[model samples]
Target: MLIAHLSDLHIRPQGMLYQGLVDSNTMCEQAIAHLNKLLPRPDVVIITGDLVDEGLPQEYAMARELLAGIEQPLLMIPGNHDDRTLMGSTFSQPYLSSTAGPWHFVADDLGPVRIIGVDVTVPLEHHGDMTEAAGAWLDAALAQEPTRPTLVMLHQPPFLSGIPYIDTYACRNSERLREVVQRYPAIERVVCGHIHRSMQLRFGGTVLCTAPSTTTAIGLALDAEAEEASYVEPPALLLHHWKVDTGLITHWVPIGTFRGPLPFA
Candidate 1:
């Protein structure tokens, strides 16, 4: 099974731009079109979050129209820039039936794989947290089907990226999130988006991957003295392919023009 992972759309109005420069909407359109044209279409597509530049009804409206192109089963969760109410109302599905809490955790079986999504958004705050109730909900969900090859997805990554600007907004209760995940060996990967860059690391016995922005990407500045910065780097999304005999693997696919797939000699 193949899964397409996209995040931090930062979608905005037709003429509007993000951070006063990036044209995210056009980038998202190109990414969706790219997904539609893949030879073996992905089994599932999950956008990790930040669906809109601002969590406005109009923004959601415009985003919904663009996202209609995706042919695969697409799943999404809340990000710091997302408003749960606005998102849920516009993109409601059977999987998002929860009403009482900020957690929108749900599990879907896809024959050889099970995709589980959870909400880690802190209201009106850029930082992320997994509440006690959300944690219990996840633990119970995983307990139900512990052996399935599950792919857990959330907005903020539990581990920190080297960039100080992004790390400050990472998941606060990381240990709680870790406890639930480490107990379930079936979880293959904890995929997330929020930093607007591609990063991966092993944490709590599982591989954690952070997707790059579908539009713009923050440069990789690993030095302690490096100042925070972002740029209009080549936009891209992630593809997680599950091989029964070999296990799961990830690929970062850029969303733009490239040379032809010439025949090998």
Candidate 2:
């Protein structure tokens, strides 16, 4: 099964720019188009939060319209930039529990993978937290289906990325989450998106990967005192391909038309 992983769309209201500079809406549309044109379309598309630039009704409306272009089953969670209530009301699917409280759910029927999406975003705040209750929920969920090749997804990565500025908003109390995940070896990956860049790290006996944004990438500055910034880097998405014997393999696919398919004879 092929699963497309997209994150940080940061969609703005129609005719508006993201952060008053980048045309994120257009880029999001292009990303959707790129997904539609894939030869063997993905079985599912999981977007790991930051669905809009702000938690506004207009933004949600625009996001709904743009995301309607996807041809495959889609799953999503709330990010710091998103209002859970608005997102839930705007997009209704079987995966969302409700428009109130955290949006957590498990989708076990989407092909060969079991997807468990948890909401770790703290309302009206940029940072994330893994509360004891949330950790317990995850533990129980994973225990329910211990042998399945699962994918655990949350908006914020549970570990620091070494980029000091962004790490300020890293998930707190992550050890609670980590301890539970460590017990579940069947988890193929712990996927996330919020930092606007593609990153990977070893975590909890599995790999944790953060997908790049469909719009701008957060500037990579490892200096301790570096300021926060963003760049109009080449947009991209991740494709997680799963096979019975191979488990899961992820590929970074850049968006937009590029001259290629040249024979190397």
Candidate 3:
């Protein structure tokens, strides 16, 4: 099974620019086109969150329209920038449990992988927390299909990336979540977004990785006092190819056309 992972779309109202500079909408359209042209189409697409810039009805409408271009099954969870209720209403699908509090669900029908999406966003806040209830939910979900190849996805990463600015609002109480994940050996990967740039870290007993945004990338500043900034870096996405022998292998694919396929000398 091939899974295409996209994150931090930050779609704005049609014609509006993200942060009044980058054309996130247009870039997202390009990313979608990039996905559609893949040689072996992805079996499923999982978006980690921040689907819109602001939690507005218009933004959700635009997000819905833009995401409609995807040709494969889609699963999404909320990020700090998203309004759970509004997003649930806009992209109603069976994978989502409801159009209400804490959008979390399990999808077992998508190919050979079991996808468990956990919502850790604190409503109207920038930080995320894996509450005791949410942890219990995840524990039970994993128990249901103990032996299935599983992928757990959330918005904010459970581990701290060295970037100091974003880490201030990073997922809190993640140790609890990590403990739960450690017990479940079937989890192939814990994928996330929100950091903008691609990152990978070892967490629990599995690999945790973050995808680059389809729009702007948060500047990579490791200094303790560095100011927050974004750059128009090459937008990209992640593809995870899974097979019995190979397990799961990820590829970082940059968006847009580039000359290639030249024979090696």
TM value for model 2: 0.98
Give candidate 3 misplaced runs (Cα > 4 Å): none
TM-score of each: 0.95, 0.98, 0.98
Give the clashing residue pairs of candidate 2, or none.
none
Expressed as tens digits, the lDDT of each residue in 147-201 for candidate 1 is: 8888899999887777877788998899999989999998999999999988889
lDDT of each model, Cα atoms only?
A: 0.86, 0.93, 0.92
Q: By lDDT, is 1 or 2 better?
A: 2
Give Cα distance to truth, residue 225, candidate 2, Å.
Answer: 1.1
C-alpha lDDT (0 to 100) for residue 116 of candidate 3: 89
Question: Which of the two candidates, 1 or 3, achieves a greater TM-score against the reference?
Answer: 3
Model 1 TM = 0.95
Q: What is the lDDT of candidate 1?
A: 0.86
For model 3, how many clashes? 0
Can you give the lDDT of residue 149 in candidate 2? 95
Candidate 1: clashing residue pairs, number: 0
Q: Rank the candidates by TM-score, best first.
A: 2, 3, 1
**Model 2 weakest 10-residue run by lDDT:** 92-101
